[model samples]
Target: MKQYALLVLLTGLLSTTSQGQQALTREPPLVSPEIHDNHSVTFRLKAPTATTATMSGNWMRSEGFARPSATMQKGADGIWSYTTDVLSPEFYTYSFTVDGLRAIDPNNAHVIRDVANVSNALLIDGEFANLYKVNDVPHGSVSRRWYNSPGNTKRRRITIYTPSGYEMGKETYPVLYLMHGIGGDEEAWMGLGRASQILDNLIAQGKAKPMIVVMTNGNVSQDAAPGEGSDGYTKPSFMLPQTMDGKFEETFGDILTFVDNNYRTRKTKAGRAIAGLSMGGYHTAYISQNYPNTFDYMGLFSPALNNKPEDHPQSLAYQKLDLKLKKQMDNGYKLYWVAVGRDDVPILLAGIGDFRKKMDTIGMTYEFKETDGGHTWPNWRKYLTEFAQKIF
Candidate 1:
């Protein structure tokens, strides 16, 4: 009986030793999406059971690839990896497909919501992309301020960016009202456009003046973005309703009044600037036209100038758009800038062309810029970087 007990103990000790040896043989999980000095990136995934793995990312095109997805090779240990060629410096979104299911990189923590989909974000650092990267510089403060919007009859939120030293000093800064496109709220510019980072890097490099950037919700109906303040209820669409016609223009004064009252700002037209993307572009054009002399600098980014007579149907406000534009010219504004991506949608390009024709007829002077790419965030961010340098 003693011998039998000794044999059982020996067997148990041998099993424990073997398990320890196996644990030591196993490799550690890699730091995925490892960025190299050469701008090439390697993505890794440890899926012991996945038979096939593939990587799909926006970087494919940037890397001179025809397709976005690249097949990853599985090693003997079941770790899958793929290294891409040198890519341009910018933020890129990517995901992995294991078998047939698409999933974000398990090792990557940076993620962003682009429209309805979520993916991992990889920042390739270089050149203009460096502007989007947060560096060790004097940073600014961003806040979501809730205020009463009598225009929509609800409390709305505006994302405001006050530059570094705003709290320490008693100086008033110029105000730039930067707005987002449709399907976006006040958070769009900061999140997707990386406006704060752009401004921070620019200010640090003495490229842009230190100023206050205010991002407002352009949607006329909703007080804020769905899930912002209204109990997290998501709506179906972001398009403006016909019922809210002419409400935005009438109630825009509320936003101005609130900002001027609460923040330390220069109260003159020279100290004010308004700029926007897509639908926000339409808003900038409309506001600048409707309220001439309100802002000295106006940036229309991919402006969707809806000047069709059939759409507005001789509405006095619509008919007066040209007149308001003329008044802006007569009032002697500092900068009237219009920019659009060369590959923008046909509808927007057409409207821009029509507006340019009108401006030509009225002899209104403005700076026109043609950027590369379509209606994309990259283009908008580039526009913001360029526009900021030109403004106060």
Candidate 2:
């Protein structure tokens, strides 16, 4: 499948198309089905050789098949067809498991990158999901903008999401500068994350304040220094933050700078916020420490740096928050929330426990939250929902 997803906002509801079967009846089964009209999907695979197949992921936690696997039928050209039930309008990940071998369908064009093996991942836009238009509130739109970097020429792309009321209303909202982890680009928030619609639902329900979110691709390459793009290529996750020889702080600074200048931003440090997931969470912690004046709130979700050795340079910075910075953080930081999943040990629960201790030693204040989900977007999304409700 093509990488780029078509953005659309549907306004009306269409009746179910099936005649003999109810909308709830067995769905058309295929490999990678794009969202067409309703919250339904049709998938097809040219697996003439395979007998049994299934699709699974976060949507229906595949706990020993809580989700019924769709049955496939052979077509004239040896294509197999199956359809997923009317799933909620959200992006999902599924692989077609054949007879007994765990493998992706060869005919599914949707593929996940960096996977050594094939992945039957597909993109289902909001229109296809049907939720994009359900609440009757206008949907938000995101724009990718470029700005001048202080000392570099390779331009970077920053994807900004503005709520429905942004342009039409006179109110100015706080800008949240969101960034993605090592391998993800600016699309991470909108694609798999569906930040726009999430924010739309929250704001419509008055659960979250209407605000603008800017997401940047945060992987910094050796050849691409601060204030520059890595030439549309991702540097290995290990090579970043030149000072650390590969940690991803310097490049993040440039991204923040660009965001500060290009948009009709609150522009002041108190009016700004920064956050991310995994690698992004690490960046949030690292940058908040160094650039004390740039953000009013800092949220770290499943932070990758959960457990760097106490002597690690990054840990050293947290330990020595400095009197002036510590006082400032104490005085103004609205919320400094750090969250981790109970099942996550990427840095391990003990790591964050240790990190909390270090913060306590330095008298640095923050909120630590725990959830049951592992290190995945569900946790990340829920973190956004909760942390956002607390932001100033």
Candidate 3:
């Protein structure tokens, strides 16, 4: 009996030892924080007990390939952090998926108004990022006003960028309603997307036209993409009607109405246009297609229009014949441009082809840009430059 008991105890001890060894072999996922001083960026994680942690981000335009240790520091309740010397003015989308807990920076105070939106930090400067920059230029002054939606929804902020010559020149400049994707606001495109600077540079060199560009938030559209039901990036066609125009859409739409009412320019379809980046690009396409009379030109850069109305995400009857997607072939719009990197999202390559095929089948005229660089800003900036020149 004693011998049997001893054998059982030995077996239990061996099992315990093996489990401990396994625990030591496994590693906890690390997240190094990213930071930009002065409301631009900076990251901090409260982790007092952690031994080691690091961060990963694609901020360097490295073809969307994450560069580990973009910034990191340890200590402070296991809190690890990294910060950049006041960064150049721009809006950056990033998250600290620390230990597998994907989250936004809590220490940072600046926030982009997005619902269920991926959290990214923002840094504003006195130049293009600041409304004051518009005033500094020769022709027009940048203005921001609060726009109210129905249902007592809180008014939203809208930013407008008019050329240095807008007010003084007796010219009704064209309007480009540039938009930001999920996790962005009105300031993103003009600030980080550099809409004003791109236009300024282009106009200075005689490459772009002097136009009144409107930057707005496009998190929610009236006609939601099918896959958007999941509340993340997917084939929009996969989304259902019940999913379209959810709460998020309601909020963003308010911004759109505000822009139309306040901006001093042509409000007709030909004078107004819309464009966006990433999710913003997708929004531009979706909204322009659905609201054919609103915009004369449409620009989509690195657009995540993965699913057309009927391709992969055929969740609705409209997906079959896409009576809802007739906007994809709207002839009333003047210009439509779709640009994406070769390796942006190989998964979406098939979707892009299908979307183009549908457009071709409809005999729609549009520009398709396949540029170098992955899902980073090089292609996006370039796309904006070209799109501006053509639209303006």
Candidate 4:
């Protein structure tokens, strides 16, 4: 009798749920960010009750980190729409402000999370942006693997991209240690930077060699990215503990050991390269110099080279910078490529200048490339594409 009663209750609940779901209003299907032949794009949103609407995107001119916004027009049919001038070929992200509230395009399925904020992704294919797309080529395998970090006393996560045919072949490949910025995690390069797509396209076009790309979380305090760690769904922050304190660089050996043991790697400095953006750039500088013979190629993309206080615990890492450069030079390396945008902040420009002056004093031979934009993912992606082609 009790079982029958429970079954009747379950049936009633399921019927109510089905009726409620059926009664819910359904939104009309709409196409958004419609790209035209001339590269002009039209964006549409259905906000019938909204008083005001605006569109903001990375493609627009940016003052520092602020992107310019465009006012959207509301039609008599209650749809908000905006059209942009011919845009350059690049991957861009955008969001809409409807009635003063920030919202992503409901029709766009492709979205990326930048720290805490999520925005819709749009790719205008052509020129350099072609490298960012997933082309018709043999693809690579990207995996999220966990390794024990003895220095940090925790199990850490890493994102590794193995080139195509890695599993079927017995050949060993070179390795690239790619690092992210202050607020990013291991997924940053693969997601926002599109490192795998860049590599696959470059390798398919015979512009780059097929290798293993290892992306590590530079934050020593966290074992993994926000929700992926023991701390569940913690909000991400630009200011995190031990990001630039040199502990992450100190504990990088754990990642190296984990990769070498698991994957079929070249296992030599000649077959290794390291590159990073922003805070990761600072890390690349320190890690490559501190372990002078570990990496043969180094790329610093908009690296933060500011000096820390003398009383800091890891102040020694910042101290004797010239001696470390000399040691790295003496040990010999294939490439030391430095790139920074002209529009980056004055402090970063000055920091890069000071670091370059030190390198000049030590007579270190390196390649430097100045781009047109500021500290952004576009610059970093471009640097990675160029750097990957140049390395083993």
- TM-score against truth, every candidate: 0.84, 0.68, 0.58, 0.92
- Model 3 residue 287 CA deviation (Å) reads 1.1
Ranking by lDDT: 4, 1, 2, 3
Per-candidate total of colliding backbone pairs: 0, 18, 25, 0
Candidate 2, residue 111: the lDDT equals: 60
**lDDT of model number 2:** 0.64
lDDT for each of the candidates?
Answer: 0.83, 0.64, 0.60, 0.91
Candidate 3 residue lDDT tens string, 1-392 = 99999999999999999999999997554443444346435566776665554554445445444434464677655667766555555445555656555566665554442334345554354443442133334343466655665632444456688877666666577788777655555656654465666676567656667778776644333222223223445433323232223233334456556665665677677777788887677667666655656777889887766644444343322233444346545546678888888877675666667777877877788888887667665467667777887874
Candidate that would win on TM-score = 4
| Stretches > 4 Å off in candidate 1 | 1-27, 47-54, 60-80, 97-101, 233-246, 306-319
Per-residue CA lDDT of model 4 for 317-353, tens digit only, reads 6566667879999999999999999999888889999
Candidate 3: clashing residue pairs, number: 25
Residue 214 of model 4 has an lDDT of: 97
Q: How accurate is candidate 4 locally (lDDT)?
A: 0.91
The TM-score that candidate 3 achieves is 0.58
Q: For candidate 4, report its TM-score.
A: 0.92
Considering lDDT, which of the candidate structures 1 and 4 is the better prediction for this target?
A: 4
